[model samples]
Target chain A: MNRKISIRMSGLGGQGVVTAAHILGVATTLEGLVSTVNPFFGAEKRLAPAESYVRISSSQIDERGEVLYPNIIMIFHPHVITLGKCYTMPFFDGLQPEGILIINSEQPLDLSKEDLTKLGQLNARLFYLPATQIATQVAETELSTNIAMLGGLVGVTRLVSVEAIRESLAERFGGRKFLASATTAALDDVLKSKFAQVTQLVDRNMEVVHKASEAVQEYFIKKKEAGSLCMLR
Target chain B: MIEQKIVEPEYLFFQADREEVFITGSEALKEAIKRANVDMAISYPITPQSESMHLVGDLYVEGYVREYFRGENEFAVMSAVAGASMGGVRVFTATGGPGTLRAFEIFPAWAGARVPVVCAFMTRGVNSPLSIQPDTIEMAFMLHTGIVMFHAETAQDLYDMLLKAFVIAEKPDVHIPVGVFADGFFVTHTREKVKIDPAEIKLPPYNPYSSPVPVMDMENVPVRHMRDPFVMKSNFISYAAHASWQQEILAAAERARKHIHKYLGGLVETENEEAEILIIASGTAVSQSREAIALACQEGLNAGLVKIKSIRPFPEEEIRKLTQKAKAVIVPEFNRVGWLCKEIKSVVEDNTKVVGGPRVFGGMTMPPHLILAEIRRCSQ
Candidate 1:
């Protein structure tokens, strides 16, 4: 909701971390906001650590390269923290006060007492979702976990509208650029694939996104209801 | 009175039929080439500079480009491109860093022959130990290449400059090669909003008849008596002939200045005019300087920026005029050699006031904070 919001997303190579950042950028732009998605430099290989920075703003953005101070962080894979697979030391380093941290895990993070204390000192908000599980169940592909995480991001941050993201998905898969008839045909082609067409894929992904987003809202609401002494589970 | 040669670019930002799109610098250059109705694009792939050519290849497939191919190497690519340009078609080719050096020998000849070709040089560190990262040391060698140069600050600038490059290079008075330069990865990979003219209304094709010297062809004209070079006995004539040709190349580049100002608005772009501390930079370094100046202004530091968009003409007049009243000129560059700084000091008076080398090379970033520190130091 600020003029600018910087998010750092970390995961292994080939996990679609860059694509997620790109989708976020496209969504932000469609929402009449500006955004830049920067993938890590150098040649990235499968299983190697990869990270991307996405900066969305209502005004112009001139900053280039990595995001040093992020208002939000998305852990596309738990290994980014456990295996120390990131350019930034400690992975969560330089997280701003009251920052939002979203982890793609089925349960709470295995952070040490010191790390937890640091997060508490910063008053950071934390959330987790079984992204891979959700992707596998809905899209029948773990690769779609990034999409689920994006859904989770929108649900939690409410920074961009869901309508904008749907339009982004249509623009991306519909091959709709430059022509109106092509947009309709492309949407039909995508939705009519063996997975059905592009529209079917987009609609299915949107469903997963909606569910993941709702789950985050419900989980956080329940946590607050249980008070400050709530269990990690 | 100031000459009335240049006009503000605001009027042409998004012309009536134009569209605004978000794309990488590489893609922006490709769009410019497409709109310019380029005849040929011969290239060999290298990091950071590769995508521009790939998009050109797409244009070829889309029937917008007449000819496109990948050469065996940069040398072959430039040779093919020069050959095509001399054959009287508007041609383009791109190389970066080591690739630039691999093809460096052909550049001067491209200008000398007055081919009016355009080449994109995406700045990268030449290989010592094999660095594919962004660096501007490659620019140091190009300053003497007899080619006109345009160093872009952002994706939009890259788009605008590449389009202008074709028009500038093909001018009858300016039949010289133009090198459109942008930093590797930094600008090439950074996606930003760019406004471009629609395809239908782009610049017209290169007219070979417009060239001062004719395109290479031997058939039509009757063979006449051999020129005086055959009877020349002294090395003096040879040297004089070569010397005058070199002077002609320089003259051509000089002629390009008016066109550059007309097309690019001016060779040097300034921001925050009254600041005492002046930051002189080009390409991606200019982007960092903009941020640094903003930060300095927030803290009440009197600072401004003079970004060199045209590196070949050197913007000497503008730099001289701008730095006349400034207390100190700080030059931030991405290359360790600080070629831009050296050029600035070479032109501007009070060399002691000009400080260069708050630099980062080998793909490392030159953050605004680093430049801010230099501004703070100079303010004292």
Candidate 2:
């Protein structure tokens, strides 16, 4: 089996969506898996709707650009849903069957009945975490919110090993400068200043990942006999 | 520059050891230039192409490049690149879309002068309303510019084509500018695993003395001549001289076939050519076609693929032959004009068999599903 996994990360700009995709891609590559990462094409403006896509496979990956049929979708901010700050309308459009969706929120946002019914039909798995809260409480920086979101993804799907994530984090922050964009490089400077050294930055971000992984909670959406909406923990 | 052993082009391209690294197309270009032993690189900032030259500038800081600087604009930069190349040194530069049009006049001039300049065109849309997105419509204009053009399908192609372009363009029998174009953003911004050679070995330095045209180094030839510029004269001699020179440029590109084959394998690469349905494309569209072909195969539609690597010396005979037995031919493109489709249609015998598109322009990605839809429709 090819076992290819496609992930789409949607978030507001300055949320490290591109950086998170880069780290995940490197981790998958380190595990001897093939992966390709691409940021959404748009002007690099803060707070704008931003997205990044990653495709990981045990075999070679030929497809490129945005992941139109993503098996995994990561939402990094509540605004992506509540404020429609997403390129993909409904935020979960084109998600694969039995797909995993990890949203960065302490509680489930009020999803529409139509959207919920569609997700239920697809048998989608929904996971939520207070990712920004974990970043601030554990990593001591909101900039680490993207790392926290990755932790939630690992908690939900274990797509990559924690050790690989650690090494990838080191490679991104401790190794050479990785430029996702000019704004990203500037944000990295602000992040690096929060820690005493590169090692400290990696260690603190790892803590954010671990806490977010454990903090993540699944909200089960089941289609009742009457087609009524009910969420079960 | 860091000390690197000068190795034969064949040895470096084929026998040299390589390692796989996940990097963006821009980074891959930097890696290629590090081992190209280039003498100088001029840069002017433009979206998609800016990062590539920015990374190349980093090479200069790291001592991998001998000389690097920013130019006033695309035209000035291209002119500087030509001047540097005419001075008997390997030179590199990059521009795209608007920048490509901005520096348009210099491209043909480079070929007419036979400077052996290697330029990377990170192709994008050039419309009235500005767009910094991937589109190859600019390539249609460049086709008649008398320069050899190669379209890269991925970052790996960008790297390999760039390195090999230098050798191809500098051939004594076919000295001319070679444009290595990659779809902006699709290849430039996308990150994927690329195999690259070690940094300790580099291609041998260019020997300008072997150039078909006079090197402007002033070493053995007079520094200034042209007392009566040819363009100033409108007699038959001047007209004939210009006409023959243009023909020579065209001949130079034709002469490059054997060299391109020796390095790039062929102008076009075919897969399952015996199949009745064919998808012919270049650049990132070829990448999309691979996915669509795989999908089509799952549906039991046996479709073949023809990847056109060299656009200038187009695989005319190859395309015509490949499409001869096919019932349907599909050409997916990222540009609005469907220039590639027009080219294939012109060469293929059964013109109606060629489908102009399923094209997505203005930076929209061609969902493999769209191409798959075409395959399914073509089968019906």
Candidate 3:
């Protein structure tokens, strides 16, 4: 009955996953929602795997701690898929049937049939966006990929307004005007792009989200109908 | 002098009914912060002291406290509090033995600049064996480093001393970094009932010193008044700076002694006026010594105790007068034999035979009975 959403963002160091987590938290808080952002990072220099979390809810959060089983998982790097022993994978276990998973990568990934079978055991929905490619197309580099992935997240979850995300980005990167402008532009492109060829990648990512949400909704409707039938019988 | 309130003399007894609650020294610390009206606290998690940081984080989420900063490390935590204090906010921080050692470099910078940063230090024995138990080795070694240090004897003391530490540290004359030290195993992990009274505590406003802000001019431009060559040659300016430092130290010490005497009243005292044997101790050692003395008295041994409330500037005069009547003095400290007891022996001088009992084995609680035995042996 709670309208709470837990999101985990992870990537190799320097990809700005930590910053993206904070931006998401601040944006969600700005939209009259309660949010918490926590990061788990070591003293590793650039290129090491870094992970952060964000939790947003309509009401005050009782748990002021870690995200054990997150509702959404954002993988910002493509290669981490191969690093199968990453600590965040356990959070995907026993997820709610309607939970959403978003991954940000440069190319569409083909999970081995074996991996797909493992994922099918959990009833949650999964969506992956080639955020690096979209960022490179709009910003001329992958420097703004975190922001691009954030745009896709806002578009999908609608947990926080895109304008709130923009405001948070501007506030956090106020000193770095060039970076802020590039990120804003990238986010705007994701929001404005049509369902066409050059933007076909973004459209495909959206299609995955759309289909997953529909499947989740259908599963829940069947569950409720089954419950009513049982009560009548 | 403010007129002292006349209240009924009652024994300070711990309410046993509340002991069943699972609480740690870290929880006591957070309760102290809430009572002291601390506006913000920032810390990074580390062993033995992480619970204090977690407690503050919990309170902030509960809306009982405001603005808790989760920093990257001990360095960030200390610097962030320094910055927050400069911005006129009452800020606090907590760290354990290793974390405190890591933060050691920032102490003089904060003290010399006179930032009233309040921190709770859980004194764990350092190096080699690497035990995280309560010991005063760190506190004894670092006491003279321009920060005011208060040792908490009990869980209640941790709560009370911390509340007092912020008030005393933020005073105009004593605007130096202050720490409330508790033994890591004995106090850091120990749980007891701590009285929390928000209404009785009054947090003073932040008042920065009148000196101009320090800035490094890499361009070699003349910033403020430059040192005059003539004055430097005459040694007048050099002498004046040295004298100024001496006077500042004396003034700060006098102010703390006077404030403790005036505010704390009977709680700060020298006992058994005619007794020829004086034992000086601080923090939990005082409680241990008191228990020892009580047992010694039962066994018909005559010895007195002097519990030091403030360790910085060493309270030399008060200690000297207290030990003047004694033919022999014993100092029991929870540190290596060479530090605080040696300092006390040096102060009390040759006339009084001084006996030093340092906790050679780290983290061992010297029982009162053992202390009584030590007193009997020393007297014989």
Candidate 4:
């Protein structure tokens, strides 16, 4: 693993993109690493385009605001790519060479030939997961889709320990109230009401995470003489 | 809530053991106030500033703060905060962007009244077409409000400055309002790691007896004997009285310089001061400058940095001496007005050497590459 990693998470406002970045940031800090997280500055409305940046390093992080050059990009919804519901143009702008891309989709979405060529030039690695499906199936609620995406992140990178992620989940949901925004707070209530207890909420989310981690599949893109070919891993 | 013991300011600030916490800047503000032993806190909601005050309200609920309430508006909140301060209590309040301008009239009143109030200004863009994004143009308006000003660069600075502001504002010679300004969203919403002193120990309560003015308490007899009322008087006596009092307020901030040095270490912190190329900034602009300097260093260019912590005092002497030897001085700012550059220009001998910006306003983050371009340009 690299000494430092910068991640950009893009999704709709209600999809818990900010929460995923926050939980991952906290988990990194819990592992005694440094991390900073911030959500995009905009009017946060349900289903509106939302993005978040998370920087995790073994040392200090001096930068703030959006991660312009991200080593990893997580698309929380297909709309971010398909419908162009993304802040950055082409949904993968500023992706570093050999960067990692994780998309929450049951199957691969079609990428433009130009984008495929660009990714091939950068030697980027890509993965896909049915995170929302996993969330509804395992946790019985779609709110855990963010957790499932995080599980996919762990399965791919192992950036943070599962123990640290569990503790961060407990601290976020069970400890003192955390407010990313008024809208996020209201969403938290809806998520909490779906469970019987705080522990149950944590446990169910963990189950979603584990299932999604196991379900995540990677795509190996081979640049052939004729065209680019993507094979499921 | 755990029982807290009153400790001396120095011990609480420097001697106490600390623990690291992964939290947003708002949580850091709450952590600072939790150990500040505040008597009262008033609230008004504004973007980027609301969360910090909400956390303070949590402190009130946890019994760390003695009194807390939501005011009718920003003006009402500032007025009520002033009233509470004059009543011999350590009062704290916060406002930003439109809220800061809405409550603008009370800032000078707090200073003139000589009430040791600590207000956190989470600066954002004031409305023209209405922007809720982070901007520091509000700090430019706050420069001459007769209050002491401290600009924080990061969450750690926000936490440290807010805690020390109480001690700085309450000095007998100072006894004035202190506004700790942090760039909104950048320092308010961004989650970062901050080291904080233990919550079991707190700074000793504010002592109103140390105030230069009479406390507005029941124990003191009320007196309203003036030979002439200044309100309607268009005479020399009235003008002279008001003029001298304004001078006194400015002098009070000057008196705070020594206290700032004692508590905050210095008005301006310098790094690699001997380098020919220099970057000078305040607030989050300083953080951007640090990154730019590192990039410049990697490119075989030597550039130093001057981070202005105390903006009101202006650090004129230090800035003058620092910029005198530098070949070029780069001033990166979060606002379009370049108020910080103007301050540096006013002090530096060769104002031509000071580059006014790689400025970005309207809530956009100052990318380090932009500042690096300036550094590379100046290196030529």
Model 2 C-alpha lDDT versus the unseen true structure = 0.91
**lDDT digits (tens) for residues A88-107 of candidate 4:** 88667789999999999998
Q: Can you write out model 4's per-residue Cα lDDT over B108-169, one digit (the tens) per residue?
A: 99899999999999999985998989999999888999999999999999999999999999
Q: Which candidate's TM-score is highest?
A: 2
TM-score of chain B of 1: 0.93
Off by over 4 Å in 2: A225-231, B223-229
Query: Residue by residue across B1-380, what tens digits does model 1's lDDT show?
Result: 11122222333333435677877788788777777777888879988788788888878887778899999999899989888887789998888999999888988888888888889899899958888888989899999989999998888888888877887898899989999998887788776677777655446667787888877755334344466652346687787888898999999899888888787888988888668899999988888888788788788898988889999977888998999988999999999888998899988888789988689888877778889999999998
Q: What is the TM-score of chain B alone in each candidate?
A: 0.93, 0.98, 0.81, 0.98
Q: Where does candidate 3 clash, by residue pair?
A: B134-B184, B134-B185
TM-score on alpha carbons, each prediction: 0.90, 0.97, 0.53, 0.96
Q: Which ten residues in a row have the lowest lDDT in candidate 4 chain A?
A: A224-233
Score candidate 1 by lDDT. Answer: 0.80
Candidate 2 residue pairs in clash (backbone atoms < 3 Å)? none
lDDT (0-100) at residue B3 of candidate 1?
16
Q: Which candidate, 3 or 4, has the higher lDDT?
A: 4
Instruction: Kindly give the stretch of ten consecutive residues in candidate 4 chain B with the minimal lDDT sum.
Output: B219-228
Off by over 4 Å in 4: A1-3, A222-229, B221-223
In order, what DockQ does each candidate have? Answer: 0.31, 0.76, 0.01, 0.70
List clashing residue pairs in candidate 1: A190-A197, A190-A198, A191-A196, A191-A197, A191-A198, A191-A199, A192-A196, A192-A197, A193-A196, A193-A197
Candidate 1 DockQ vs. native: 0.31
lDDT of 2 by residue, B30-88 (tens): 99999999999999999989999989989999998999999999999999999999899
Please state what fraction of the native interface contacts candidate 2 reproduces. 0.67
RMSD of each: 5.7, 1.6, 17.9, 1.8
Which stretches in model 1 have alpha-carbon errors above 4 Å? A112-121, A176-194, A217-233, B1-16, B219-234
